[model samples]
Target: MNLSIFFEPLNEDVFANLEKPRTLGSYISYFVSKFPDWRAADIAILGVDETRGRSNEEQAEDASTAETPARLVRRKLYSLNKGAGRCQIVDLGNLRPGISLDDTYLRLKEIVEVLISHNTIPVIIGGSHDLEYGQYMGYEHLERVVNMVTVDSSVDMTEDPSVPPNKRQLRQILMHEPNYLFSLGQIGYQSYLTEPEVMATLEKMHFEAYRVGEVHRSIQEMEPVIRVADLLTFDISAIRHQDAPASEPANPFGLTGEEACQLCWYAGLNDNLTSLGIYEYNPELDDRELTAMMIATMIWYFIEGFYHRKNETNFTSRHFTKYAIAFTEDNPDRMTFYKSKNSEKWWLEVEPLSAEKGTRIVPCSYEDYLQATKGEVPHRWIMTQARLG
Candidate 1:
């Protein structure tokens, strides 16, 4: 696929002030005269300009127009120093929005599917949060179930079909068929901004939901949650307005800048995760481009984690220590867990009732291990079993 046909070339000035040596810009292959060679690249950057998914009312009410999110992100990224590995990254430039929102989604889906098949990670920036619909659709042709992890303030479901895309996109993905989504994990949700029923729906589906408070209490626990994802998206609105004022429908409470970066780092380390989208950034609302800088730092951390991937998920590998626990004969609940000797990260193993397959292992916290030792089952283990069923 010739990507140049669907993308607008980067403006000369977009790279004008960038430094030459050791900066991210020096490491990036930008689509200036032509599209970058994605086959040789490990990661690809794409920008989307469509915003029709945003509520028309909010678009009309905001006096200040939104700035091009991808441009702002590029400016910030180019100023940063490159991480320690041979990172072959290509910037695909901004995608040309289709005549209709659905058309744009289709274009994005096609582009993403091609990239994934080529083994290049797509680092998507900009467009409305609903643009993730295209991101989600990218997995349709893979023929395998995908686990998606999202960082947002709400589940984004609505009873009314006519609601804006941002409010109903999650519902759309959940109901999408021939269903390829194996499970979903939502992080950074605030109770005030979310409906109780939405959370209930996730629980009923045996999916994971973590509130803002739970994340704030111990953000590292989210590392395992993110590790399970094949696809992930972050809504800028999930960051507190003080740290990221660029979010539309801005909120005062959410993840801090540092916390957001940490989450990105965890995502970067996940070998299974292939695509990441950071959306809902309204640069028109930014203060001194602080949010843009914060986002750039998050990307930086993610790249750092990517280079430092340990590849220690294999329990049988010598890099990990295995442990097993058995409950009383009456209880009948037995569990196996693994801990990485290097990173100290933990994983719990579950066996399905059927003997057709081996035990399924999932990323878990140390607390889950402690619970298993005490003859109790962690909710995460139970949820994984339900998902298998």
Candidate 2:
């Protein structure tokens, strides 16, 4: 599969202008007509130039006009220092927009499918949030259930067929055929912006949607939630308008620039996450590259966390300590938990079914342990059980 045909190389002038001494540009492989030898790389970066999803919105002009978003991001990215741990990363440059918007999605889906099949993570710089639909579609041939976590200011649950996907992408993903989605989680949603009915629907479906205030209260709690996702997308508009003013849906209050980086770090640490997209950055509305720098820093943190990953998935290993807690004195059923001696991260073990060969380990916080100990089940545990059933 010659992926180069689907992508164009980053402009040589862009790289030539970057100060190469101790910068990220010196380390990463960027595509030319010849693709980088990406088989050994841990991650690949791709940029999309399609923004038809913004056409239906009132502020379509704020979306990226073809290559501007990627170009600005690349400039900022080249200036950052590579992380402490070694990581093989390849930048695939931009995917040229197709004849139609659907054509563009098809192209992205095929490219992403190839990357994931090769076990290389794709860090996407998107033209609009709806491009993530293609990212999700890439998993169709993988023959496994996928969980998606999205960082957005609002859940796009509108059922209006006339609306562009940026307004209702989540609804489309949820109803897509083959039903490969096992769960969906949303972080950094603003209560005021999201419709009450949409929130109620999320609860009814038992999917997790965290408010911005909840994340501010305990950012650590977000790590486990992010760890459960196989794919994640960060909507740039989720950051406060002051920090990330370039997004069309930008709001007065939301996650801080620092908090956005922290969430990305958590996503990178997850053993299950194989794909990530940072979407909706509009350079036209940015203030002197401030938003671009913030986004670049988020990417750097994600790569840092990726390199620092500890392979703690093996429960039987000496690296883990097990605890068995009974919910009630007379109850036969008990919850099993594992704590990593290295990272001190917690995981709850779910009961295996008849056809299952091993127990299912779900990411959890210490609070989940406390809840189970008090004869109460964590919502995560209950949701996992229902999904498995």
Candidate 3:
């Protein structure tokens, strides 16, 4: 695909000022005079300036003034010191907004599909949360059921006609034709902000929803959930207004900046997760670009975790410790779990009902193994079984 035509080169004046030695900008190859060679890259960073999907048209109009949200984020990201990993990252430049919002989505979908087809992970920045629908659609032709993890303050599933696309994109994804979405797991959603009917609907469909308080109780438990995702979309509104004041309708209660980074780290470590999007940051509303820096740090942690992946899926290998548990004497159902010696991560094997289906390896936690040891089936195991059945 001739990608250059779809993107506008990064503003040289903004990045040229990043003259600090050993900074991340010094290590990254980005589009300025020409598009970087993305074919050999491990990860590609792409920015989208589109914000027409936002509910507040005034805010969207203000976004187009001078420094875009994406550019502001880039400025912060470039100023940071280089990570420990040897970086082969490319910045694809900001995408040119199409004549219509739907047209912009189509362009994003095409770009994402092309990058993923070459095994390059796309780390998307800027735009409204609604752009996630385009990111999800990129996997349509990949011929596999996709598991998604979304971190947001609200469910974004509204059916109200007056609601803008950013607030209702999740419903579009759930009801999209030629459905390939296998499961959706939401994290950091505030109960008061979410509709009771939508919550019940998600439950009836067997989808997972984690309340903000639940995430606060134990952020570690959310790792297994994130580990199973093929794509992840994080809205800055999931962070507290004090920490991320640039968010649309900033909430007083949400994840802390540190907790948000931890989730990104977990997502990066997942071999299954192919793409990530960080959205809903309005630079105009920011407190001296503090929110922009927060988002940049989150991206930094994700990239750092990416280089630390162990790739430990082989159960028969010497790098794993296996445990077998029989659920009950009468039930005679046995479950197997594998713990990675390299990373201490856990996974369980689910037996397939038919020969054609084959066995499935599900990401899990040490707690799940303990549940089995006590003669009880883990909820995750039950959910996987139900979904597979």
TM-score of 2: 0.94
- The candidate scoring highest on lDDT is 3
Model 1 C-alpha lDDT per residue in residues 68-129, reported as the tens digit of each score: 88888889988898877888889999888876778888999998999999989889996788
Q: Which stretches of candidate 3 lie over 4 Å from their true place?
A: 56-65, 352-356
What lDDT score belongs to each candidate, Candidate 1 first?
Answer: 0.87, 0.86, 0.89
Give the Cα error of residue 141 in candidate 3, in Å. 1.5
Question: Which of 1 and 3 is ahead in TM-score?
Answer: 3
- State which candidate has the highest TM-score: 3
Error of 3 at 300 (Å): 0.5
Alpha carbon lDDT at 174, candidate 2: 87
lDDT by residue for model 2 (235-293), tens: 99999999999998659999999999999999888988999999888877998988888
TM-score per prediction, in order, is 0.95, 0.94, 0.96
Question: How far is 282's C-alpha from truth in model 1 (Å)?
Answer: 0.6
| Candidate 2 residue spans exceeding 4 A from truth | 56-67, 352-359
Return the candidate ranking by TM-score, descending: 3, 1, 2
- Candidate 3 structure quality by residue, lDDT tens digits, 1-389: 78999988887865777778888888889999889999899889999878989863543343335788888888899889998888989999988877778887888899889999998999999699999999999999898899999999999999996898999999999999889988899999998999999999888777889999989999999999999999999999999998999987868899999999999999889888889999999888998999999999999988888988888768899999989898777876789999988889899988756666777888999999999899988888777766676
